[model samples]
Target: MSARRILQLGNPLLRAVSTPSSDSGECERILTDLRDTLHEFQRTRGFGRGISAVQIGEPKRLLYLEFRGRPYTLVNPEWDWRSEETFRLWDDCFSFPDLLVYVERSCAVRVRYQDLCGASHVLEAENDLSELLQHEMDHLDGILTIDRAIDRNSFCTREEWLRQGHPATRPEAFASKT
Candidate 1:
């Protein structure tokens, strides 16, 4: 499978709402392309953790996220559960190119999705991987993190993100109890 080119911000595809997978055959191919695209981003950007089909100009409900060494595919993925606890962290997207923004998301989430074989699976995720999955899954639903950013002023370049204290804290809005 060939790696697909990523669609940057302002691309219409990134704004298009992706449709869910209809059958097993279509899902298999999308899964392969998703895997290839995930690898391509990691290789070129040196730090892509997840990507959605919409980001590649495909309006199919497919996404891939790399955890450790394995790439996990989530087809028609949705959050089945989310914790009241929330976390704020730095997030960047391939579509947005080089901009990084501090954003808030659920600290722990359980998602349900289908695999290439059409088998449904529920996954429990936490920490950065949890955030990565939710971020990409949002793309499938036509949601971008920028839409939920706590501070529009918090937007910055990757270098700026480094210049800040670089502390990982709960989202300012969530008011988590430590």
Candidate 2:
């Protein structure tokens, strides 16, 4: 397994709906490549927590997550629950690392998925983890953060965001339109 090229923002394959993955032989290899590619991204770009198979040109329902020193391999992940309460944040993607999109997301979520070995498990995430999972899950369904932007003004370049001091987002910030 090696670090594969990440599909860029304009790649048509990024719009493909991923197919469910099996516990067959390719699971381990794909997961490995995902981890390698994630590490490579973090090393080069300095910020990346998770990646989906589709991001690496694999149209499979798989996700690799590493956050807070723990790693998770999610196969065929499905939403078990999503909180009604929402919050807003500026989200970025490895595929489009230079752009940030302001979007809203649920405050919490529970997901059902299988491990690399095919063991079924459920994960409940809150706050930051919730948003991160939602982002990656969107990738599985051929969605990107830009698609969730709050409005035409919700986009900012990484450079401009930094120039403006990388504004902090409260866990309760709604950025409501009403």
Candidate 3:
């Protein structure tokens, strides 16, 4: 029930794929730590929607998110479906809070996951929620936003991005997933 240190980029642990958690008690503890860490980040950094267990040096497939005033806990989540339509955005991560990476993600996605009680549930999301889930799920697979950069110029510091007038303009034609 305490905030844990977030692993930064270049940490080999961040590159290791997370494993599924088999113990409900362990999963619950990880979820609590994630929630605390996310809240701390929001309080100090001013912005953070979701966090994965791997970000806290725990290689477990767990994620905690707070979106639109609602909290979500996902364990062993897997994508059920992804829309062909995609959108580009300046994505940031708690692991690398000071950097913004331009990446593309599905406009809609359906994810299946287990809750704290070990019950399975499905979530259908679009727009912002869809993008957020995709981003966090990537962490479970050891994929960071930087790994999905659109190009060599797809990265910039948070300060530079703000200086550029927050150029998060949507692309006209949606790019196909590669």
**Model 3 regions more than 4 Å off:** 170-178
Q: What lDDT tens digits, residue by residue, belong to model 1 across residues 1-178?
A: 7788888877766767899886878777767787887778777777777888887777898888888887788888877998899977778888885677668889899999888777899999998888888798889877887776766555667675657554465345533322
For 33-145, candidate 3 gives per-residue lDDT tens digits of 99999999999999999999999999999999999999999999999999999988999998888898888899999999999788999999999999999999999999999
Worst 10 residues of 3 by lDDT: 169-178
The residue-by-residue lDDT of candidate 2 on 1-178, one tens digit each, is 8999999999999999999978557778898999999999999989999999999999999999998999988999999999999988999999999999989999999999998778899999999899999999999999999999987778889998888789855223334432
Question: TM-score for every candidate vs. truth?
Answer: 0.88, 0.94, 0.94
Residue 174, model 1, lDDT: 39
Models ranked on lDDT:
3, 2, 1
- Which is better, 1 or 2, measured by lDDT? 2
Better of 1 and 3 by TM-score: 3
Q: Model 3: which residue pairs collide?
A: none
Candidate with the larger lDDT of 2 and 3:
3
lDDT value for candidate 2? 0.91
The residue-level lDDT of candidate 1 at 12 comes to 67
TM-score of 2: 0.94
